[model samples]
Target: MKLLLLTAGSRGDVEPFAALARRAAASGHEVRLALPDRSGVDTTGIDARSLEADFSALIESQGVSPLAAMRSLRDVVRPVMRAVIVNAAQAALEFRPDVIAWHPKVLSAPLIADALGIPHVLVELVPVMTATREFPAAGTVTRSVGPLNRLTYRAAAGAGAMFRREVDEAAEVMGAPRSRRSSAPAATLLPISPAILPRPADWPESAVLTGAWRAREATTDAAAPTPDPALDAFLAAGPFAYAGFGSMAAGDPAARGRALVAAARARGIRLLVATGLGGIAVPDDARGDDVFVTRSVDHGVVLPRAVAAVHHGGIGTVQAATAAGTVSIVVPFIADQPFWGAMLHRRGLAPAPIPRRRVTADRLAEALAAAPAFQTAVEAAAARMADEDGAAEALGVLERLAGRPRNDALRHP
Candidate 1:
């Protein structure tokens, strides 16, 4: 089978899909991942289609704060997102994939798949993509309130409305039916561990909650020696903690690094912080015996060795921490981060969810202090997740959908 994956957003958003692409390829399926150009995605062995766009520059302009960016979303991202969708349509026409698995942020995926006469699976990394009375939207930290809870589902997909006309126009150009009521994906795949979030009873039968995704293999950086030797030595030194924000560009990465150093110093815990795309700034003198700073390390290699993991509550990071059975100190920056943080707290994996606004040095110190309490929950969740293979489950969903009637949006689970 030939699989085309349309992915957008940050590293955390793209990594799991890339992992799945790798898995699919290993199983004798040809896979191609279409992502925006210069996004710093690693695709050494996989077939990747690069879309033309300065996605990095766009993100830099918007800042890493999800809430701050959301304030001007329609004004800032609408045009770029539209352009990307057009690019996606072109890619669809060129690749002509048998099945398209797409990120929720790829608003034009359904249209592309519909035009190509294939099945499109809505792959959600987080549960907030669909709304239920179970809880408020992932972007929020509130409980349900009547009809508003359902509106969150609309809110997450609301951006689709902004591009609906263009998508329809593209579908027309591609000779697809224009009367289609909605461009919703053919089926939904929630690639999260049931250990972290069990499937909700109210979710449509078309939606399925596979286990959390953890690639059995590892990818290394050719540019630099990775899982960096220095980091390994630091972990061997003693019980240390790791702090990183993945793709969330911090307000001041270097300053954030300094604060992390200070907080760890105060709490009397050794710390190793990963500076992703310069998420943190480390002075020449800062990389010393006790408090270490490095560019990036594989969570699979580092998290388990550490006592805890401090990071933005990205689904990828959450799953990594859970799989490592490492305690989490989630400092959410925006979007579904708060929801992940809350879930960690409610599940007893963390003491609390620290919003970026409240992530001062003292607060981080206290969060670190409470790390040990998360051990029991962390171990249990990891054990449960270890038994699941989300990539395999996702592949099964795609394979089954591929054999069924192509245009039936409501025919799946």
Candidate 2:
């Protein structure tokens, strides 16, 4: 079976699909990853395809300001949706995949799958539109809007409808009858464990809860030795806290960086800060001796050595920290982050979420100090997640959808 997997966004969003692609290939299926041109495809073992005129420019645009990008996405939802549809159509025409596996945000894949008369599987990293009262809204705050959270529900449904329409258009373009579009069967794969997000009542039967498919290897470069001897000394001292806002550092980054530095110092712990897309400047006082600041480093390598992990609570970051068996201090800013933070805390795997608005040196210090107690809980959760065969399970589902006859060779051997 030939599988076309589509994903977009930061490294976190693209990496999981890449991992899935690798697993599918290892399982004897031909897998290709279709991603935005700017996503920095490694293209070593898998077939990598790009869908942009200038990938670097696209990434640079997104990296300018995390908050701004989020706001822009909210404001121009239609245009963004259209761009996704166009990209997916182009990829589908050329690739002619037997099945389409797409990230939830890449709404166009389902439509293309319908047009091509193939199965479409939506991969959700977070429980955003998955219909659970588990966490807060993925967007900015809002006042109560009445029963069933109709406002939020409508927003979610509208987004779903928009994608549905795109899929219908793609079907027409691919010469499928209109009636088929209305009845097209869609399936979803939640790339998170049920332990993190319980199966919500509102979710349809088509959706399956699969544990996160994380790569066994770290994709980012290793942290280089700090130039300052004091910083080097700190690294040698003991396991310290790893802190950063994954990609939400653009809004007041200097202030946020300073606050993180102060919090780490207040707790008397050494820190390694990832600058993310928007670079976080290390405070002059915190820079020279004790702290190390880098643009990026593989969380898989660093999280295990850390006593605690403080982050913005993106799904990928949370999974990485949890898999490493490190306690978490989630400071969620926007999107599904708050939901992830709340879920981790409710599971007793991390301290309570510290919303970006409420994050301070004192608050962060307290969370860091409390993190050690959560270690036992984190290890248990990690063990449970490790037991799930996500990549294998996803492949099994994909093979069945492509109408391929299942045999022992596909599963094992």
Best by TM-score: 1
In candidate 1, list every pair of residues with a backbone clash.
193-212, 253-280, 254-281
Q: Give per-residue lDDT, candidate 1, residue 329.
A: 92
TM-score of 1: 0.90
lDDT of 2: 0.69
**Global lDDT of each model?**
0.76, 0.69
Model 1: lDDT of residue 296: 74
Backbone clash count for every predicted candidate, in the order shown: 3, 2
Report the lDDT of model 1 for residue 174: 63
lDDT of 1 by residue, 1-413 (tens): 88999888777777888888988888899888888766655788989887665556666777765575667667776666766676777778888889899887676677677667677888888776776777777776545566667777667656567667666666665667664654467778888888888777688888888876546575222232344577666777787889988767767776677778888888878988887765667676555677887667777778877788899888888888888888899988777888888888987888798877776788888988888878998899989887889889888888887745475544321
Cα deviation at 186, candidate 2, in Å, is: 3.8
lDDT of 1 at 107: 67
